[model samples]
Target chain A: MVITPQRNIVSRTWGTSVGKKSVIAVTGIVFLLYVIAHMIGNLKVFFGIETFDAYSQHLREIGEAIFGYEGVLWGIRAVLVGSVVLHMWAAFSLWYQAKKARPIGYQHRQRWEGSYAARTMRWGGVIIALFVIWHILDLTTGTVNPLGGDESAYLKLVASFDRWYVALFYILAVVALGLHIRHGLWSAIQTFGANSALKQNALKTFAFVVAAVITIGFAIVPLSVMTGLVR
Target chain B: MKLTLRIWRQASPEAKGKMQKYTLDDVEPDMSFLEMLDVLNEKLVLDDKDPVSFDHDCREGICGSCGMVINGNAHGPQKFTTTCQLHMRHFNDGDTIDIEPWRAKAFPVVKDLVVDRSAFDEIIKSGGYISVNTGSAPEAHAIPVDKVSADDAFDAATCIGCGACVAACPNGSSMLFTAAKVTHLGLLPQGQPERATRAINMLATQDELDFGGCTNVGACHEVCPKGIPLASIAQLNHDVLGATLTGARSD
Candidate 1:
């Protein structure tokens, strides 16, 4: 029952809601940048298998002169893993705190305002989490990918998306991700104190545009594969 | 005007409450919402029944004491109006108004339509003050403040410590209320010394309490009687960030 402030500044910040929201905002920006970069990389598939495969190889070969082979990729992987962990931790703790705050429900509750995206943030987050796990297994590990671990990266991607069901799942996950990003970006901006009265509309529009582009950008790869355009 | 009322009735904090319906006749449209309640209580007293209990003080809407969820809206259906100031005219003839207490774990029901809002006091007690020595009053222009900042600070200072923000929020967050206090002081030169400390301590106190985390749904400002802007919350975030980054703990 005795609650004392943590010794470290970081841990102390974690003890407050504002601190948790800051974590969510910062980590969200990291994910946002990663997704944009990922979408651009995925678009290389349109240039044929050589360009796509070479692009994949180039990612691993980044910082080769200084960090040695695969060192930069591993570094990026480490950062991404850290970001995901912090993001999920902050999100879950906030959700738990919110649930604990309202032990009783109103007999007649109404959400006349607030965006649909904001309302569904929790469930959208859950869907995205599940999707990320499935995505890593399918593409990164080649465990769930139909092409197995023997095929090239391009071939594995093509093999997986060539199936209608797999492509459908990817599309659905991407849609959920779009909704998450839409609300998360807006919320993050507000949390970081970047929003103002004059800039509110602009920020909202930017959120929608980013969400739409990322969703459609990611969706195109699987869709092209299924439609025989990438073959 | 005639109306039907479905008011939440709870005997104690642990009692299981439910909606008890009542029919009110000879209701006047010009009567304030609280006056209608008073009439209802008189009838209940005449019938030898326990009259409903609710909070009210300075019924002119200055004091934040009066608050209730009327027809699913905090402080009644009218925008930017307190329960006491809300008139029966807003309700149509024969309308059925559903009244409930402010629902939040931090503010438990003391009785029907009355909750213990001392959690707000704890948040204020944490840092909502200036450490000024008691002596002769200082000169009016001892410390000059800019017009904009002063105005903004004044706006934030209008917060009445009402729990309506928490009651209306889907998450039951007190961010708007806490943010108003933080911004009001943080903007002033006097509040500069403890700016970072105030942010950290007050936010920590809020976390320790049962109040929820803010998701920036922007519902709090809508239901707020004083129309406290969401910008105050943005200011709160700015201060908290600075405090955390600098490790500014008063202790």
Candidate 2:
């Protein structure tokens, strides 16, 4: 069969940096929302192992009445995977575009402009990507988890945190994620054309608060587990 | 005053460029940066050597024709000053200044200190103008623009198309230059008809020309000779988003 040349809207738009930026902004917000929800869900450990285990089981049973078991969970997973792929694609393309813009390097340069978060975006993204892979292996696949898949969700969490290195790594990853979210949120809003001189301070504050809350919220889980507070 | 210059010398656009050293004595402190270069060029001419070629139209700052990365800073260390307007008094005796052209792929070097900035012109040609039927000059009072908006428009309009913003940008972004034009037009009544289309078209051209994305570095504002504020870029973003969402057409 002959393949037809079809011009998709995405292909047409993604040809430009502005279009790529729009993709990045939309996908970034998706990841931000997911992280916030994940943090809250993880916090169920504070209510006891039954509550946390029930919460984990509830995620798998979502939409079971209509679509059968694990259907809604798969749906959520699909969306998240799509978002991550799109986000990474846009980010890499943008980075390439930036590199192409300046073919030569400066003999002497100074970082007189840009924010700390803005400067660290590339490295922070790398850290987060590495953390994501390690996290899935340890928790979801039970490959590196000390308690293994046979144990309860609460027990696995405690077991992983009891290893000091694992908890420290988790804390570091969350901190990097926090920095990424802090800059990403403000940049996304600006990209979407939601910023102005009058609203600059308020928007910045909102970005900082959201990032801090999510990071601290996630960090508290591993810390509590390691301290035996949750165990 | 005495000074040492490490100037980039490239024979042509395709030629390999390198830093060439030169020492100048009795350089008056009152001489402008461009004037200092002129003295050096004069010396080269007297010595029967090929003088350094740099672009300059009006020696004044309004033309935006003259620019060089002086000592790693666009237009030198003086804030909001053009290369032609920078005075040598800012430097002391025995200072070594490194001079190089803008190092963006979008701006290919023409010679020693000049780069092709026709990309900026193409961006303007895309959609930086409004349609008008020529008849007679309209009265100034005919259009009643609010003072705040009129001032803001004037401020944005002051951008001289100087590539300093791009040169100073870490990513080599032309957002400030494009945004100045977009925001200037978007704020006016006459520009309202093409506001949406102008934003979309100009930004599209800018991207096509291979300018980097703006990460809100604020470098463009810092190095702008006209002191164009970063707010203009925000307005440009606002306009582009509105145009894209509303599916505005250029026709």
Question: Which candidate's DockQ is highest?
Answer: 1
Tens-place lDDT digits, model 1, residues A93-153: 9999999999998988654447888888888888888889888899888899998776778
How many backbone collisions does model 2 have?
A: 0
The two-chain DockQ for each candidate, comma-separated, is 0.57, 0.37
Tens digits of per-residue lDDT, candidate 1, B12-31, equal 99999999999999889999
Model 2 iRMSD vs. native: 5.2
Which ten-residue region of model 2 chain B has the weakest summed lDDT? Answer: B242-251
Taking the tens digit of each residue's C-alpha lDDT, what string does model 2 give over B1-251? Answer: 98999999999999999999999997998999999999999999999999999888888899999999998888899998899999999999999999999888889999989999999998998878889999998998999999888998999999999899999888889999999999888899999998987887888788778888887767888888998877788788888766666667654
Interface RMSD of each: 2.1, 5.2
* Candidate 2 chain A: worst-modelled 10 consecutive residues by lDDT: A1-10
CAPRI-style grade of the A/B interface in model 2: acceptable
Docking class of predicted structure 1:
medium
